[model samples]
Target: MTIKVLVADDHAAVRAGIVLILDGAADLEVVGEAADGEQAVAMARELRPDVVVMDIRMPRLDGISATRELAGVTDVLILTTFDIDEYVFGALRAGAAGFLLKNTDADGLVGAVRLVARGDGMISPGVTRKLISAFAAQPAREPSTRDLSVLTAREQEVLACIARGLSNAEIAGELDMAEATTKTHVSRVLGKLGLKSRVQAAIFYSESG
Candidate 1:
């Protein structure tokens, strides 16, 4: 299936550039564009695209708020000019699939969109050290910590793999489970733990140790 995408950025040139690259992909389509956060939210509801490339800062509404609202409605891959640690931290907190720097090369941008469309998150390796350490510093007493006992043993095993940065396909292979079943398990982990993204779950797992 061709993944339909909504590009939301305040700058006309930026949106056009994204459309140019995305429209070139044979299996991807840009069905809509929004110039601000409010329009991004509205467009997602109206067009129901599979993915939304959101900007962290925009007029009318910031990307975080829009991301919060659009979380389950559509996957959000933050497309922002800021590559600061705080931006990545907040975007992930808002349940964004990942963060993409505006100056990213064409191949990197296209890969990010495709990865998010596949229900996977993308984080740049440049920020990996900061993110891993920041999340590691989170207190164990923090509210998002969940009780792993609630999950079946296999589910707990799958959740741990997710925390360890394994993709659903990798988890399936590691667990000798079907990919479909692996997705179901991953979703159940998120729902049961009140977690938003794998990043959050990873934080909990690392902090719990």
Candidate 2:
């Protein structure tokens, strides 16, 4: 199935570049473009694209806030030049399905959109380790009120692998299970934890520690 996408960036040139690359992919289509956060939200609600490629520092709402507003509406992929802790944490907390640096290559950009559209999460490889370490170093937040006990033992193992940033195939290999089984465990874990995506599950595990 073709994945519809909305590109949002304040810079016209940058927005055009993103649209060009996404439109190049056979399975991806650029349905619309937005120049700012408000426009992004408006377009997203109207177009209901599979993914929205967003920039952080727009004039009106900012990507994080727009992401917050878009939480259950559509998945968001934050593609921005900033890799600072604030933006990274902010976007994820705001419910972005993926976070990527603007320096990412065309293929990486295409891959990230596809991954988010598949209900998975992607963080730029360059920033993933640092983001996890920083999150671990911060004083632990209050324990999650969500009950992890609801998950089966296998599902718990899957959650741990997610916190370690393992892909579905890696989790399957690690646990000596099939990849399809791993995906089922992952879906159950998220559903039981009341989480939106793998990224949120990872954060929950971190906060629970």
Candidate 3:
């Protein structure tokens, strides 16, 4: 099936470039383009694209707030120039499925959009480690540490692998299980933790550790 996408960036060139890249992909379609966050949200609601490629510093609503509003209704992939963007944590917490740098290669960008469109989370490897470490440094509550007790031993192991930025295939290889089984464990972990995506699972594991 063709994955419909909405590209939102303040720069016309950036939007054009991304649309061009996506248009080249046989399975991806650019359904709409927005110059700012508000228009992105409005177009998203109207177009209901499978994914939204968003920039954080857009005018009016901002991508973080827009992601919060669109959370659960559609997936969001944050494509921006900032690797350690100040708004990165907020966007993830607001329900973005992935965070990517604008400098990412064409294949990487296309792959990330496809991954997020299917409800998987993707974060730049360096940014993932940095984000986890930064969030882990914050003061966490006592009860938050105990939340891991709810997970089974294998589930805890899966969570740790996710916190380390291991994909399902990697986690499966590490645990000597099939990739599909690893995915099941991941889904269970998220459901048990009341989390939305692997990004949240990673954050929770980091803070709880």
Candidate 4:
């Protein structure tokens, strides 16, 4: 299936570059381009693309807010040059399905888009460790016992793996399970916690810790 995508960035060059790369992929099509976040949100609402490749620092709205607006409507894959912890945390909490650095290679970018389009999640491997460290200093909020109680022991282990920024393959290897089984556990955890994406599941686990 061709995954329709919208490219949003403040820089024309960056947008063009991303569009060029995505256009080369047979299964990924560039549906629109936005110079700023407000335009991104509006165009996304209109186009209803399968995914949006977003930049965090735009003129009017910023990608974090734009992602929030597009939540439940279209998946957002955040692609920004900045890897600051705050931006990472903000985008994840705002419901982005994937976070990638602008410097990512063409194959990685395409793979990430496909991942989110297929109802999965990813964070650039380069920043995954940094994400964990940032969460370490964050204060835990009061957790919903009723929500967390629904998880089985193995599902709870899977939640911790996600909170540690491990992907399904990594979690599967670490926990001695099949990758498909791990994905199931991740989905179950999200459903039970009432979270929309794996990023939120990670944040929820960290905040509840």
Best by TM-score: 1
Rank list by lDDT: 2, 4, 3, 1
Reference-based lDDT, residue 81, model 3? 84
- Ranking 1 against 2 by lDDT, winner: 2
C-alpha lDDT (0 to 100) for residue 98 of candidate 4: 92
Candidate 3 C-alpha lDDT tens digits along 103-189: 899999999998887657888887878875886677876546677889999999999999887888889999999988988998899
> Each prediction's TM-score against the native?
0.92, 0.83, 0.78, 0.78
Candidate 1 per-residue lDDT over residues 26-127, each given as its tens digit = 888999999999999999999999889888778999998999998778889898888787788888989998888878888898898888877667887766
The local distance difference test score of each candidate is: 0.84, 0.90, 0.87, 0.88
Cα lDDT for residue 117, model 4? 80
Clashing residue pairs in candidate 2 (N, C-alpha, C atoms within 3 angstroms)? none
How high a TM-score does candidate 1 get? 0.92
Tell how far residue 21 is off in model 1, in angstroms: 0.9
Give the distance in Å from residue 188's predicted Cα in candidate 1 to where it truly belongs: 0.7
Candidate 1 yields a Cα-based lDDT of 0.84
Residue 66 lDDT in model 1? 95
Mark the regions of model 4 whose C-alpha exceeds 4 Å error after superposition: 138-144, 149-192, 206-209
TM-score preference between candidates 1 and 4, better one:
1
Q: How many collisions per candidate?
A: 0, 0, 0, 0
TM-score of candidate 4 on Cα atoms, chains taken together = 0.78
